[model samples]
Target: MRAVPTLAGGFPDISEMTVARQVHWQRWLAAAAILVVLAAIGRAFVNGQIEWTYVSRFLTAKVILEGITNTMVMAVLAMALGIVLGVVVAIMRLSSNPVLTSVAAGYTWLFRGTPLILQLLLWFNLALVFPTIGIPGLWSVRAVDVMTPFLSALLGLGINQGAYTSEVMRAGMLSVDVGQYEAAQAIGMGRLRALRRIILPQAMRVVIPPLGNEFIGMVKATSLASVIQYPELLHNAENIYYANSRVIELLIVAGSWYLLVVSILTPLQMLLERRFARGALQITR
Candidate 1:
């Protein structure tokens, strides 16, 4: 290719047609690859091996419905606990007190370092190490009795979620300008009051988006509870497939429900992010 003169004499001129042609080829390659993959997937779905009829029949099965309800309940309760613990730990991590900061750091380190499945198993099998449980003389119970599948799942998922949530909460809080805190303090506001009234509202704009993603992730993560024999959606689906010997169909049923839930949640998350972003946009403008 011959170099052409440019407006700037020091620089070589590039051919617009050449660049456009390259881009055109790249786009076509990508489009073709996508189409091929889609076609393969379509062929697989249409293949007689997958038993689509069974998938449809069990899509609205009673047990699957119950499983979905349980999964939602687990996600909500776990996320609620996570949010509460996250807020507390985030505040503690931000505290000036060394002890509180250390404790918060330790908690995050411990939970985030471990695999979630390990945590669930540990909680489920805690009875092996601690045979009895109680609050002194006030109450007493066996460890196994206390650590039901539901409770084990909650503790495992919720506590693990808290470690991640705390980091997110802390990042959001830190995103607020330092002067905002000083300004709040200047107006005769206590730290807690300032945080509640002046800081959190702004922080929520940053927090809501990631928190929404985490909530969506939690919905999928609930399937881990199945390892502990918790009868959430995937667990129930597994039970049905085991009984019916129609494994792939039941998987499709479970997957369909997950897609449905996520599709519903994505818009809600966007709405919340937008709602919390009101003041931020104005301030930036």
Candidate 2:
């Protein structure tokens, strides 16, 4: 402690106190234990049966690159489709009409209740139910030809994503004050126009975080399409391993790519959140 004299000679001296830093022994012990465990795991993997050469050699293979490209393409397209569907379904769910609400509810229930892999399989084998699908007279095509692995994966992943995304959208819209709706109506704006011009913009800030996370999930979900023969990263990795019998190495390569993608996307998501949160009192940084 240090005493400082006040400007007024008659005033008592003020004592300056120093804060003592706390040493958390428990925290140090926990960190040391975790480091030890991680070191052990790393050593095991380094000495394990996985061939590092195979991982390095195939990481940038043409097929692997193509597969990652396809994965990103599918993720973007599917998320776009999901967002469109989710917005529409959320509007329908919030509608006053019983029929629209019921239909939207059923759509969400049906898609969300079922397993995504089953949906992919069903879409892939649509020919079993409908041999041909097209306009009655203007056009026609075999279902088998139309429902390729790409289309199957798209429909399966997009529709499932929509089911979950609808809830996120609905929550965001609900987060807005009801007074905002009344205020918009007072300005002679129709319900849809009010939503477009006022509500949705404000809701976007609240929704962006969840939506970004969902997109990351969608990127990983592309792997599920592998079961339906979609040539995504995991599928291509599987093919390489199947041929070379280097399963762990190929999986590690694929995982590293996935991690790289997710890492890149994380910063992008933060940027998007900040963009949407502009003008708000507390913006996401």
By lDDT, the best candidate is 2
If scored against the real structure, what TM-score would every candidate get?
A: 0.90, 0.91
Prediction RMSDs, each to the true structure: 3.7, 3.6
CA deviation > 4 Å runs, candidate 1: 1-23, 282-285
In candidate 2, where is summed lDDT lowest over 10 consecutive residues? 9-18
For residues 1-285, could you state the per-residue lDDT of candidate 1 as single tens digits?
A: 765667575766665435533357888999999999999999988975888889989999999999999999999999999999999999999999999999999999999999999999999999999888988789888999999999999999999999999999999999999999999989999999998998888889999999999999999999999999999999999999899899989998999999999999999999998888775557543
Position 102, candidate 1: lDDT? 100
lDDT of each: 0.94, 0.95
In candidate 1, where is summed lDDT lowest over 10 consecutive residues? 14-23
**lDDT, candidate 2, at 277:** 83
User: What is the alpha-carbon lDDT for the whole of candidate 1?
Assistant: 0.94
